[model samples]
Target: MTALPQMILTPLARYGWATHDAVDRDEGAVLRELGRIGEMLGARIAGRAGAIEETIRPQASDDAHPRSLSAQFGLNALPFHAELSHRPRPCRYLLLGCLNPGSSGAATMLLDWRTLDFTADELRLLESAPVLVRTGRRSFYSTLLSPDHAFLRYDPGCLEAVDARGRCALDLVRRRLGSGLSEVHHWRRGDILVIDNWRTLHGRAPSRPSSGRRLARMLIDA
Candidate 1:
């Protein structure tokens, strides 16, 4: 169930992402399959995490797994953000393998920040903007788009404006995305998509319960 990670790595610079076919794949046993695949790609499995993979499917926010993305967002669309952005340091890469394509309405959405052309003034303001990001009982201040790293750390759900600049930056970012500039990653059964989590913002489009769409996700380190 694993793809050649090196093959995906080679073309990532230009494609922003890569894909490999699982070929004659079966959905019933892919959760453990993804875990094994994640281990092959060096998944950070030694932390507090209970497992190295997750199954994404439609459910109510009040479901048993309330904290899950499937529960929080349900069949609705999700906002653009990196995986694990709420953590102290997000995962470096992500892999998503399609199990069920559903009714075809559930597509993965992507927005590459490197392609955004921010004005010098806006960039300057963003570099200085400091927002308090809350993660449960923990919180930290970050500029979101820091110059020290190529990655972007952002999640609108938890950002609390710390100052005028932070507030402006937050509003500005929201407006920027409001422009509707993004790429759509359509999925097919047996297809695996690899993403550089640090370099791209990703989300999900709407789905219907009847579609039966499902995807397996895994996070790995560099």
Candidate 2:
């Protein structure tokens, strides 16, 4: 049997992401490679309901507060947050690739949790405070810091809607994860990015309206 390509696990652990460039353009080949890598990581491909979402600009709507297709489809913009925050089984890893690079604004931004610098008081506060996350009709509560591993499960926009304490915590986290440490990735054809969802927050920059950018996304669970 042919040997599978070895997975690169270091960058994702240390920096919260591992990027692979010039991936095979064939979709079937790419999926197979991703599946193999996912298996090596002891993670299964996430199911359809929460996996393989396509982020694209929407057609113009006449509503007073016109929302972009991304927002309409529940795809989040540049807010610092973990994916599937409201779910019992949040994705352990996220795989994102560019299918079509739009004419404007579809860059993805990532923040490494390891790089965030918080004061002792702020850390204590984050560890103690509970954040309420609500998506559509579903709702749940979680702390920013995991009691066991101190991993973060943050979604600032959700917190901003719920209460003052949560908002303050979000602000503190945002301040710590300033522009300096945040990494912005402009997608090219055949590029794939794997992120450790529990250790990183991912979002996108505002894309131009009707720009044809399309991204293929998948989630994995360990």
TM-scores, all models, native as reference: 0.83, 0.78
| Positional deviation of residue 153's Cα in model 1 after best superposition, in angstroms | 1.3
lDDT of 1 by residue, 16-93 (tens): 677776745787554555555566666553222456566667665565253445555766787787777667777877
Instruction: List clashing residue pairs in candidate 1.
Output: none
**Lowest summed lDDT window (length 10), candidate 2:** 63-72
Candidate 1 TM-score, true structure as reference:
0.83
Per-candidate count of clashing residue pairs (backbone under 3 Å): 0, 1
Q: Give the worst 10-residue stretch by lDDT in candidate 1.
A: 43-52
lDDT of 2 at 141: 73
The digit string of per-residue lDDT tens for model 2 on 58-137 reads: 23334211222233433335566777665655678887766677787468889877677676787777776767765556
Clashes of 2: 1
Q: For model 1, what is the error of residue 133's alpha carbon versus the real structure, in angstroms, after optimal superposition?
A: 1.4
**Top TM-score: which candidate number?**
1
